[model samples]
Target: MSVSDTIVRWRYRAVPDHLLGEILTKNWIDNAIPLLFLAAVVVAFGSVIPDFYSASNVAILLRQWGEFSLLVLGLTIVMVAGGIDLSVGSTFALGNIVALALLNVAGWPLPAVIVATLAAGAAVGLVNGLLVGYLRLRAFLTTLVTLIIVRAVVDMLLLKYSVKIAGAFVDSDAWYFLGEGSILGIPFSVVVAIVVAVTLHLVLSRTRLGWHVLAVGGSRRSAHNVGIPVRRVICATYVVSGTLAALAGLLFASRLGGAGADTGLGLEIAALTAAVVGGNSLGGGRGSAAKAIIGSVTVLLMVNSLVRLGVPSGANSLLLGLVLLAAVAIDVRWLKNRHKVLSKVYVSPTYAALPAAPPTDGDSPYAVNDRLRSVELIGLGDIDGPEDVILDADDNLYAGNRTGDIVRFLAPDYTEHEVYAHVGGRPLGMAIARDGSLLCCIGGMGLYRVAQDRSIEKLTDETNRSWFSVVDDSRLKLADDLDITADGRIFFSEATVRYEMHEWPVDCLESRGNGRIICFDPAAGTTRTVLRNLVFPNGICMAHDGQSFMFAETWACRVSRYYYDGPKKGTVEPVIPDLPGYPDNINRASDGTYWLAIVGMRTPSLDLALGMPGFRKRMARRIAPDEWLYANINTGCIVRFDESGRIIETLWDLGGENHPMITSMREHKGYLYIGGITNNRIGRLKLNDADPSWTGPKSYWGRT
Candidate 1:
């Protein structure tokens, strides 16, 4: 009776018989750029190399990349979580040596040896994670130390003996099978690596675990505020890194038929290079295992080809270094931030069912750069919310602040300081006065000025000549950045009229482009719109060549050059196309090199939202008061370009501790000064011993 009743009851449940269907429906592959690139690289290699397409050679290649692939996959997780383990290569070598020693010298069982080796790797990673995640160490510095010490330890141990361990636990047959044999014509090692890659890829792209990692990496502080256990997650990432390295060590030991010193030599650099090259941002957040795998294979193939062509390892390293530098320089950091305009693909009519005016080109600007190259922290002593700053004719520095003071840095060393004037408002953008005073764009109270003796005077409260908003609502305008022109006019950007400083995203998603480039004239004591209906117009810079100037449209992800004195006084041209991130304050380079500060970047989701105004507004409106969808601004940094829009270099401030939230990057004389709208102090740094090529603290680009 019991057996029949049990069978009858179980027949209906059967673990929900439609599990496969659910999996098929929910599987991730909608935007598999990494896999596509990976397949493309393999195919390209096959076409070029004679044996690459052959099954046997392909199997071998898979095995080769497979060993490194584990490390790459592990790195993907950590990178997604916004951390890295440069000590992995050392720990990898450690695993190999330890495993070999365990099996051969200590005569341990294979299972116990494998476990011990993995434990050693985990321990190494733990040290890195504890210092970086828990103890608040810089990921780069902490792992950098481990990279040196771990490599030194390995080198000392290996060079001291030229040691070799011949494992006697697993017979030669098993080793051969692992290294060279295949089941169903597929190398077991490659298969193992594939399974791992697929599993991790799914985890990152589909599961909550991947989402959590990305959330944490994208904004650690935000994630922590949301109770994401950021430190634990970051530390766990390193532990995963260690596990993968140990596994890779197992595979490496087999491949060589024994363990040696070079088992994982220089692997840390390779892993880092692969992660970054594959587009795992060095700035943290915005990465995937699939992408990392593709990147790893691509790097591996590139090296293989170079080696085939008689390039020394040193030369290859040099080439790799250049590639890594160039890739980061391109601001892949911003690829995750751009919203693509819909020209009729991927956007459905349901998402576009707005009963409103149809959009024309530039009718609206985007909600949020091409990319942030790097941030050079220029110290300005202490000032609360040092929002915006500029230089004067004497090379003396002046920065406005929420401290309600126009603070002046009187000397080169920044030691001589003074609270020049108290404006009694949240001062934002500021400029040098024609009367040798300070003109500041104070927040909430419009633009104001300070006298030589520190008297504050209000310039103008509102504009009357031109409407800068999409709906002609004057209250929507908020005075932001300002620049003084040669004709005694002040051209300023109202960041958003609708949303003050706090509700910026709503202004962004509304996509109304409700900002403007307004010109204020001292002679007339009036203001007019030079250009209206611009999105998040930020960073005003007059061209040093005397023809025109440029301004960064932050939400739109491009910098536009506007001519002032030419026949094409209203024409704007793109200085950089497809910025990876959102641009912020841009200032003219003293040496003709323009520095554009990218606040955030373009993301696929944001791109899709661009085509669907309703979707964007819906998301924007539905966002919880405490929740926000910020671009990966904190990751990576600002970019520098020549006069002709050529990329010169990048300034990266990964992990954003001292120089976090770099909204404005100003280069003065020999030092580059950085100001974040959110921070209290101005950060400073020396630029590779200072570029003597640049000059500054002048009348700003052709102004008399």
Candidate 2:
């Protein structure tokens, strides 16, 4: 067999992309892997050493894990916040020493001793926080220094005082009960560890503080720009880490009945190893307290099993090192390849045969014209991917660009342009509200409004997620286009639910029904889904009568109409069933007709490939993005249609030299404002026969 054939055969046997995505994205998967590994360890050890599952041994295991779990919990938080606390072991040792000294030597009250020990640990964390957060020191280096200093101080104290908790204190029932006592068959220490883990888990997953921690860790610069108080978040993580480590030290001292210089030796490595193995990323922003507990248990189990199997204590270090290295490598690889893996699952559509060529005769109804060829170029090389353009009542032109800016050009000459507002997502379609606020559909961010003073307010960003979705679909994935109704309701289209805005082409390959139509009422301050499960819904525009709206589903190559009032209220039907190319934005023409922008011409090869689902899936996995057969978006045309969806006139940029991938067009006065996704300049086509003062905003809201 050929190499290509062999590769295909191999891929067929591999895990499918959709299944892999489902498995990887599941929350239970993280804990499940460790749990399975732990089970395997238990079974293997139990077979060789019969007493492995004995009640006494299990109790011993829980006791050991309890103290170790405290350190792991703190480290997990630090790691999740995109920082580390290497001084945890030292802090742990210090807590034990301080507690013992205060309790035995100074004869202090138990509560006071516990308080002082925790305070001492917090002091160390405070120093680390100041250096790393306020001073902007590297977490690794700063924590390493703190670890050394703390460890040195611990050693000096041990040498100078030779301090140890008295045996009499250990004999006290009150003190001994804390470490060895049992409540309803669960050890007190184990109970404490369980409470701490559960509490931290809730905090990390549910609380605002947890969200900020994750946000800061996910992208520190992004967090700072969004006003998350990056320094404070980082600082707080260190303090929590230090305090938890001290608590763990106190537990260790109480259990062992004394404090020693080597009490927490090598404990830092164990804590870090557990956290990493628990599926927490060392790079930050993704870990949990449950993961830490599981990791700690796994490590403890491995060590215990090794001891029972006649393995030397020295081999434990080597085994831990290997495991840590493997876990880190696997996690990094999974994260890096997640997108590529997801892309592979998209099964391309296939046709029974090649699609027929579209006729483009000059004599035909869909003719080629030079209406845009000699147009004036505005914002050339300054605007990036201005998908749609609109004009306000005062004749100011507004266009949403790929760089997340809504640019405005002062009219008459249209020479001066400025950024009206920055929405931080690729802004696709735009419209002017009756009050003159600019409403825009920002891809991946949802709908937003920019007021007269350039201040942006988010109108809506959520929708009712489908039950079939594996990820949270409530957040708008791609808010493609929108239009306002006469009754002050805003109608919009979400391009796709499965993929993000950047992966638009990928969703096209899948041809899945992942798009939806939504409506927002400004009066009620509520947003709701108007329609669901559309095929890449792109552009939206209100009907001339204001009782209905028209939307274009780009992948399906069709335009549909939905009526909320009149005879066809709450009904949907196709306006144009099949098109010559992929449709983008549809806007009102000066003469009451509508103009639609065809972004790209349909091709036979893409249609044929889309028909064969198996072949398309295999191709997606084997080929690179540039090599994949895609919808022909390199050349485009603008076609005018009446209320009945019959084509009247067509304007083409055949060579795509002047205007390629035309996405939007608006008729204003005697000129047509054209926007292209791939063009640097906005095209202006002059219409000699059209009215001179009829702008787009006036045409919609009309001199009110």
Candidate 3:
């Protein structure tokens, strides 16, 4: 075997058939594991340790977890924004000392002391933010220095004062209640912590600031390019962290009735551990406030249990260190293998082995022809991936390019091209509307319309999600092709709702129903699903009767017909039962037939692999993309079909020298225009018998 063959064999293997449930719930498991472990620890310790779950001990647990919870919440925000603040522990210590000094030494009012303490924390955080965000300093180093400096200064102040506040009664009752008082059998501190956690959870999950933070963390460069306030978002996260840490310190000092130098000594590490153990990614953009709470509870439970079991203080530290290391390692591995785990759960459809290619003799229907051999290449080096091409009444050729642009080649020599519009996504099948607007289906984005002034407008990017989908499926995942009806209704196909546009091949590997057909009615201003649970629905074209439309399910290797008007309205039937290759865009031909572009041919190896879902799953998880058994798209052919689903003729580019992977084909004025997703140029094939003056818009709407 060749080196490539050996590599392919090693990558392909069988996966367990019964692991679908595990794959679907992997994310929930990641979040719930820490909570479950904490529960187990509680049960184990409570059974042996005396009064471990007693009322008094439970209250103590709540108070301790509450204090740590505050710090963890702050750390979560900073971490989610892709930054780290090592000075939170120091800030907590400093805030406590400042509060005590203001209340006891300066003789300030309790409220003023509390505000000033929190302000001090915010100020420290501002400095860290300025250094990291504005000055572009490394977050770790900058916060580390701040931690040392703040800790030393706070410790010096505490040593110098060595004073305690002496008031127990009416004067400080309100202040005392904040930290030590109880409400409805729960500690006041615990109540406060719950409130803060709930509020921050809502803020992080529902607000624009939360999105900005996640975006910046996911990719700073991308966030900047999209005009997000990356630096400001990062800076604000640090400020929130400092403020919360200070509040935690105030609660600690109030509950203990005194401030100590080592009050928050190891709090930074503890908070970090809680965040990570709760499934928050340290690398950023993938954590939540709720996770922080669960993590904090888990960490506190372990420490409390150890202390109750007579474990030495040093041993407690060692245990925590080990736990932190384990948690980080688990988090990193989970993040790295998440996609693989998901792939394991996908169940692919079984496909029969593809028969040998039909004889290419001159008398055979599948005879090889050189129709595309002498094709002229347009936009040779300028355009990339013109997946679909169309023409207007003036015979101006238009094609969607890979760079999110729709380029138009003016008539008369058809050489000069100009960028018609930038759709901000890969534009696919296009249709000319009655009002002269261009309707385009963008890959990642949804169906859009390009106006006469070259302005792009989103018609609709969402449809009714399937009832079984737990995910928010309102947004279109991959809008592949679209066709406009005479009555202003638009029919489109979402290739696969499960995967993004770039992961199109992954959808084929799964071979499960992840696609659907949708109809957008401009008159009603609504978009609704016409058919559901389709397997890779692709090209769409209106029928000659204008009462129905034909759409292709690429992975299923068939074209289906759906009638919107007439006797078969609200029903769908197969147009073409099978094809030799994966069909892409289907356009109406001048002779009232349809032209279907086969993007890829079926290979024996790929056909056999499809029959074994286990092998496909294993390949998805283990093999690199370049080595995967992708559909054979290097060779292609365009076939014409009549209304009865009978093949009229086949045009092949056997060598693919000029036109490879034909995704779309449009017949205009005696010429067939072809486009491909990976090709760098547009192809033109002249036809001797077709009308020389007919254009797409003229055929559909007649001359204005």
Candidate 4:
């Protein structure tokens, strides 16, 4: 190899640059900036103030964090449900006054005081929920009104009972413990805060209510269309916010043992800043409990650090306003542009240099001929994009189309056809199981079965994830083909994990080893990857010996055999090391040979680009997707080969008028049935010297 070729190969193929792009595409990446900022602030504060990390000061900080975190968590839930609660601060103050009045002026029991304080907060929340959710009032204006009303109520109560509350004192040990006691070296309030945080996290992540909140926040019209109780979810979120804010106020009253006009003042603004800075979206539907806690801690630390630095109160407010402004700007821009950035970097091209294609021009074994030119067309114009064809025991032909329907034609005459099943995903390769059920590979979905009753069931959509992979490889992204073994194990191929079905062209451009072979055992109910890092593994056919199967790597233009059972198990060996065109689905022939479909032919221009990864990468980045160079899939032909990998003959539609770009072919009842991914019909060519009684099902399962 030349020096340039070696360097290109090592840089593009060996180095895992694509993983960086994959990491950027993950949702967790949104929290990275906030976490980093939090770390930087803590370091800065600790350096400036020696006492910031002292044990006594740290305990004081934790006590403050406990109450502040609850307020932020409540707001986070409300925002996630596509609403806001500006009344949280006012409700907190109201709860404090109500708790003090019940304890000192009314002389109620401690439990009654707690209950009354909570009810006051809930009542405020109910008004907001009813106005915004049921009456269709704007959330911002409704909550603002409630904030004013609740604050006014708190001021009135404080004016009426300020003297009596200051003099009265509770002497009970339980009351003192609730206020300033420690549990296991942690503050009593902090322990309660941690428990509440964990419970809310579970509810948000693992419950149906959380899913409903996200759905409603994402799109209320869509949520309602899907039968979600949108208004009720919104109302419930406000109620949750109110209850949590009240709880925080109760904790504060316990710790402080007093109330004033400025109690809970500007608390709402601080909570909003913390939630937004922590990485929770103000636009809603995309946040978590962790985000709320992180934001709260970061903001709380900064505020305390400013006070310790002796910064003027007005200047502190100015600095906080600036920080909130910066956080909001970053959040809005990141939310708007993340997907755009992902699209630009996600399609990472890599080096791919296939061996020189076999000779097909002259008297070589792979020489093309027009043997398929005069083949009869079946269901012509009545079907579209029949990627693969199969037949049942009665010789009834079934073909999957681009519209996600499996169409079936009656036997013998081949005139009448009907939609066999509506699978709802583009179905590719198919096989008839011994139990008379039809197993199919759906493009975006995984392996599925169409039973004798025509009911559809998913076999498996995931496998064990690869340990070294940056992207999650467990979910089946593009299941391509399959063939069953003698022991009821189904061996299949996944064309590419990084791209979806419509993105196959992008996979072709990359030409990387993004494919794998998988095995699904019926008895054990397990699916696993048996082979990894193959180049667009497409076609799968159980070898005649039953111990192995032949799979085609499309981009590499070759076929290989994988031993799944017996002595040679877990081994892979090349069957057809080179081909003139891109190989797709492979099927057993009636004469014990195999039929391979050349989905696309190779060209010198494309071959040159594969060796130059730099050129493809530039093209992908600079050129519009529709204008970029694409593989020539408009013209394809079928090749017949024996078990020894010797090409016996090649067939083509030289006129390109029928069966253009063949993707699959099946032999049944003396005829070879052809299907194409881009063609509008099925082609049937009479095999001159084939077994007339042979059918695919009969060959695999034997006579019933």
Whole-model Cα lDDT of every candidate shown, in order: 0.68, 0.82, 0.83, 0.89
Estimate the TM-score of every prediction: 0.45, 0.78, 0.83, 0.97
lDDT per residue as tens, model 2, 1-704? 45754564455435344545655566766677667776787787779887888899999989888888999999999999999889999999988888777777778878887888899998999999999998999989999899999999988877754544444444367766767888899988889889999999889889999999999989999998988999998999899889989988887777887766678887898888889888888989888887888889888888878887789868987898888898788678866886676555444332222234456675666666666667777889888888999888878888878777888899778899988888889888888999899998988788899998888999999977667666677899888899999988999999887787778887877675678999999899988888886888988989889899888988788888999789989899888877878899999887888889999988877776655556666777788877877888888989888878888888887688777669999888888889998888898888786778777777778772
Q: Enumerate clash totals for all models, in the order shown.
A: 39, 6, 0, 0
lDDT of candidate 1 over 1-704, digit per residue (tens): 25643553354234332233223222233124445656776677667667666676556667888888888888777777877788888887877777667766676777787789888888878888888889989888898898788777766765543443542544646655666767787777778888888888788778877777889988988998988888888888898888888788877766775656576777888888888777677777777665677788888877776776678999989988987786676435345332321111211111211112212124223211222233333453477667666666566677777667778877666667788888877778777656766777776678777877778888876765333222334432467777777666778788765456656765565444557777778898876667776777877877765667788877777788887777877788878655667788778765567877766555666555555554554554355634634445555366788666776666655556556666776676566777777766676655655554454435353232
Residues 1-704 of candidate 4 have per-residue lDDT tens digits of: 88988888888756886787889977788889999999999999999898888999999999889888989998999898889899999988888788878887899988888888888888888888888888989999999999999999999999999888899987656666665788999988788778878987888889999999998888899999999998889888888889888888888888888999999998888888899999988888888888888899999999999999999978888888888899989999999998888777777778888788878778888777788888899999999999999999988999998899999999888899999999999999899998999999999899999998999999999999999888789999999899999779998999999999999999999898899999999899999999999999999999889899999999999999888888999898888988888999999998889999999889988888889877887898889989887888988899889878999888988758767779999998889999998889999999989998898988899962
The digit string of per-residue lDDT tens for model 3 on 1-704 reads 45754454344324333235434644556677677767887788878889887899888888877778999999999999899989999999988888777877777888888889889999989999888987889999999999999999998887777554444222588777777788998888888899999888888779888889999888899999999988888888888899999988888877776777687898888888888888888888888877888899888888788887899989988888898899889888878986666655553433323334444556866567877888889888778989899888778889888788899998857789999998889998899999898999988889999998888899999987667565667799899898988888999999987788988877787676678989999999999998887889999999989899888988777888999899989998887876778888999888889999988877768867766655776776677767888888888889899888888888998789878779999998899999998998988999887888776787678762
Put the candidates in TM-score order, highest first: 4, 3, 2, 1
Overlapping backbone residue pairs in candidate 2 total: 6
Clashing pairs for model 3 are none
Name the lDDT value of residue 622 in candidate 4: 87
* Model 2 TM-score, 2 decimals: 0.78
Winner by lDDT: 4
Error of 4 at 265 (Å): 1.0
